[model samples]
Target: MSPSFRPRAPRPGPVKTQEELDEMVRRMKGEQKAPDNYRERSLKLHGWICAKCGREFDLANLHLLTVHHKDGNHNYNPPDGSNWENLCVYCHDDEHSRSILADYLRGDNRKK
Candidate 1:
């Protein structure tokens, strides 16, 4: 190895306290970068309607609403909102109760 190639420092370990862990989870739950400006663009393109039931709504409903990916890829959140489909409060709750949501998103019931 060359003397100029120094090793990088190891990162700090995971949070020890419940509070710290919760904070980290909350931050990661939503993509905080750029304040989700792209989401607004999607809502506009889609007429801010719940794609499943054809229900119409405004952006403020976002507080109680969500955009779900049918194929389930958070990383593939539709930059143009094509991959996004609006979900109302009821539908959102129902979808998450299914195995697809539980297994992929929550990783619950996973074998240890």
Candidate 2:
């Protein structure tokens, strides 16, 4: 070891108050596994059928179907589910790939 090289002392971060810690825990619990109302509504509105592949889903394989945002804006949910479609996981991946391909053709190299 070089005598000139000294190890730096460990620094402590700013401590949160007990109230802040409690609030952080509460927020984490609320957001960690919250369900989306739009997904639930879309399922009820459109049923468990893939719009692209026309595959039907029931409670046995309901997880295979997913709600897709038509305009690619997930936050732009409509009450009528007009911007939402039920798609199988495979079709959803293909849909996103097509979107990416379109963007690439237009010289937009951003990855989604």
Candidate 3:
């Protein structure tokens, strides 16, 4: 049999101590940037109301409220809140469904 056909044993790597592993994890976490709080900023700027259905939201039911990007680009958030719209869960679903249907009708097979 050729050398290429021979099975090779796995190479052993240096095992890390618990303290070393913990330190590595801590350094990784520290190096990571905090997630953007655009949702909170959008809620503050556009009030707690759905732009499409005009449904209002309060602290108790604020979970149903979501921030939507007007231009369909999630990364195109502006500080002035021009591209963001506060939408209720139902309206948000409907808005996405309409866009999907429109795209289907137009034969847009490209994934968004």
Candidate 4:
């Protein structure tokens, strides 16, 4: 197949009815439950420091730091934080930008 001519496979998920889709949107917008406090726990487990740039954060500036999933799966939080890293906002943005650039270079435009 040509580079841009890959065949489209059927998406892998149960088909939802219209009402179910609407309800899901509503829940996501307003009534979604908390996502298991992984961020808070990861922050505590790894200290409020940027693993990328080694920047430190205190309570006053801690909001500038964010927990990043090393493997890019938010739902895969392990108690030991083996796949987590604390990165400052700038570093996190840079990391994502680099990933995007790499994907573009490799012609990987499809959503993962």
Please, what is the TM-score per model? 0.49, 0.65, 0.68, 0.67
Off by over 4 Å in 4: 1-35
Sort by lDDT, best first.
Answer: 3, 4, 2, 1
Give me the candidate number with maximum lDDT. Answer: 3
Runs in model 2 deviating more than 4 A are 1-36
Q: How far off is model 1, as Cα RMSD?
A: 14.0
Ranking, TM-score, top scorer first: 3, 4, 2, 1
Once model 2 is optimally superposed onto the true structure by TM-score, how far is the C-alpha of residue 60 displaced, in angstroms? Answer: 1.2
Error of 1 at 31 (Å): 18
| Per-prediction tally of clashes | 0, 0, 0, 0
Q: How far is 4's C-alpha from truth in model 4 (Å)?
A: 57
**Lowest summed lDDT over 10 consecutive residues: which window, candidate 1?**
31-40
Candidate 3: tens digits of C-alpha lDDT, residues 1-112: 5568668887899988999999999999999998878899999999999999999988999999999899988888889999999999999999999989999999996996
Which residue ranges in model 3 land beyond 4 Å of their true spot? 1-32
Residues 43-89 of candidate 4: C-alpha lDDT, one tens digit per residue? 98999899989999999999999989999999899999998999999
| Cα lDDT, model 4, residue 57 | 93
lDDT of each residue in 7-80, candidate 2, tens digit only:
89778899889999999999989888655589889999999899999999989999889999998898898898
TM-score, candidate 1, is 0.49
Candidate 3 backbone collisions, by pair: none
